[model samples]
Target: MATNNIKLISPDSKLLQYTQIELKDPTDAYLESCFAAIQQNRYTIESNTLVQIGQTNKKS
Candidate 1:
């Protein structure tokens, strides 16, 4: 496995980002679990298609 440091630049701004530290072998079940976790949890809609993590609602 490898680690990658990412940077984002916007007009007048710069930010640092970190990718996941662990990489798993790909599989359908793994994908399903990930999607399921996301779908079942609460999320706050930041926009039409964007959401902030850790902002999930308890009612979900």
Candidate 2:
């Protein structure tokens, strides 16, 4: 199953409509619901010392 025919023109070029898309598969999930994980980080290391704090956008 593969089909692709697209033609959309305008701006004095007329003929502005025609589309049929389905190339059997175009990478599913497509980003698994888009994406909205701006920034997230949590770290803590003992003994040797290491710490990071800058967490927001907790997805709520």
Candidate 3:
């Protein structure tokens, strides 16, 4: 199975949300739900590292 990697970016190309979806439970609605939850008060992913699980520059 393949994994789905998604990164939501802000208007400034900042990372607002990051997600990893497995084949078992990956859906557009699920993804959209995850995105909508943080539509407001979002932050850009100023910086991230490979070691980190996700990236969300909520303070950029």
- Model 1 Cα lDDT, one tens digit per residue, 7-31: 4455566433333334455654454
Put the candidates in TM-score order, highest first.
3, 1, 2
Query: lDDT values of the candidates?
Result: 0.44, 0.35, 0.45
Alpha-carbon lDDT of model 2: 0.35
State how far residue 11 of model 1 sits from its true place (Å).
32
After superposition, the stretches of candidate 3 with alpha carbons farther than 4 Å from their true spots are 1-12, 15-26, 42-60
Kindly report which residue pairs in candidate 3 clash with one another: 15-45, 44-57, 45-57
TM-score of each: 0.28, 0.19, 0.28
Q: What is the C-alpha RMSD of each candidate to the true structure, in Å?
A: 10.4, 16.2, 9.5
Model 2, range 1-60, lDDT digits (tens) per residue? Answer: 211232447667734333434334444222211111111224333363544555677765
Those runs of model 1 whose alpha carbons end farther than 4 Å from true positions after fitting are 1-26, 42-52, 55-60
**Residue 36 local lDDT, model 3:** 46
Clashes of 2: 0
* Poorest 10 consecutive residues by lDDT, candidate 2: 31-40
Compared with the true structure, model 3 gives a TM-score of 0.28
